[model samples]
Target: GAGVSQSPSNKVTEKGKDVELRCDPISGHTALYWYRQSLGQGLEFLIYFQGNSAPDKSGLPSDRFSAERTGGSVSTLTIQRTQQEDSAVYLCASSLGVRNSPLHFGNGTRLTVT
Candidate 1:
């Protein structure tokens, strides 16, 4: 894809259900990031993966949230035991590893918990 691509652009999961969101980063890019922006909330960093090393998963809100990147290109985020409070727009971004490089964002997967 020319830019970041996220799947299931909108997800409406019932409370207590589990949902998985996927992301495909730009080719040749070595950095991928996952962030979330909820209603009236700022962009919150969820995780970052770079070049096969361990992913920076510090931003995950809780133990129920987990993510992984395979082949250093595709990534998936899983939210277990979803709750209404988890509803938000999950955005995926990618960029070159160069210092100060800007990120290219996907349209995002808007997950709405009902």
Candidate 2:
């Protein structure tokens, strides 16, 4: 893909269900980030991965939310025990992992937790 790619453009799950979102960053990009945008709210940073360094997960809301990047390219975000409040657009972005590199974003996965 020419840009960041996310799977399942839309996903609807019942409360308490588990959901997994996938992201494939642009080739050669070394920085990946996950963000969430709720209705009428700004994007909230969820996690970040840069090269082989430890991922920065400080923005994750709770233990129910987790993410992992494999081979510094593809990434997955898993949400367990979903709640209505979890309904949001989950976005993925990638960059060159350099200072001030611009981010390329995917067409986020819209998650609706019923």
Candidate 3:
């Protein structure tokens, strides 16, 4: 894809279900980031990956949220034991991993927990 791509544009799951969202970064990009936006709210950083360095997972709300990047290309975020509060649009972005690199974002996956 020419830009960051995310799968399953929308998802609906029951409370306590697990959900997995996938992202494919633009070719050759080394920085990937995950963010969540609640309805009419600002984006909240969830995680970040840059090259092979350790991912910055400090923004994850709890152990139930996890993410991994493979081969520095594709990434997946898994939400375990989903709650209603977890419902939000999950966005993925990629950049060149350089200072002041602009981020290209995916359309995001909207997850709704009932």
Candidate 4:
């Protein structure tokens, strides 16, 4: 895909279950990011991967949320022990990892926890 791609556009999971959301950035993009958007809210930054350096996970809401970028391309966000409060749209974005580079975004995966 030319733009960032996210899988399982919609997910329904039970409370206490685990969920893994995937993101594939454009080929050669050095920066990938994960964000979450709750209903009627703005995007919340989650994690960031820039090249071989350690990822910035400062934005993660809790210990249950984690993410990784392998080979500087594909990334995944895992939420353990899903809760109703975790329901949101997980958005993935990518850029050149340079200053002022525009990020390309995916439609996002809408997760619902029951």
Error of 2 at 69 (Å): 0.3
- Candidate 2 Cα errors over 4 Å, as ranges: none
Instruction: Give lDDT per model, in order.
Output: 0.94, 0.97, 0.97, 0.94
Residue 19 accuracy (lDDT) in model 3? 94
Clashing pairs for predicted structure model 3, backbone only: none
lDDT of 2 by residue, 1-114 (tens): 588999999999999999999999999999999999998989999999999999999999999999999998999999999999999999999999999999999999999998
Q: How many residue pairs collide in each prediction?
A: 0, 0, 0, 0
TM-score of each: 0.96, 0.98, 0.97, 0.97
- Model 3: lDDT of residue 43: 99
Model 2's TM-score against the true structure: 0.98
Q: Write the per-residue lDDT of candidate 4 for residues 23-107, one digit (tens) a residue.
A: 9998989999999999888999999999999999999999999998877789989999999999999999999999999999999
Candidate 2 vs 4: which has more TM-score: 2
Using TM-score, rank the candidates from best to worst: 2, 3, 4, 1
Worst 10 residues of 4 by lDDT: 67-76
Model 1 pairs in collision: none
Better of 1 and 3 by TM-score: 3
- TM-score, cand. 1 vs. native: 0.96
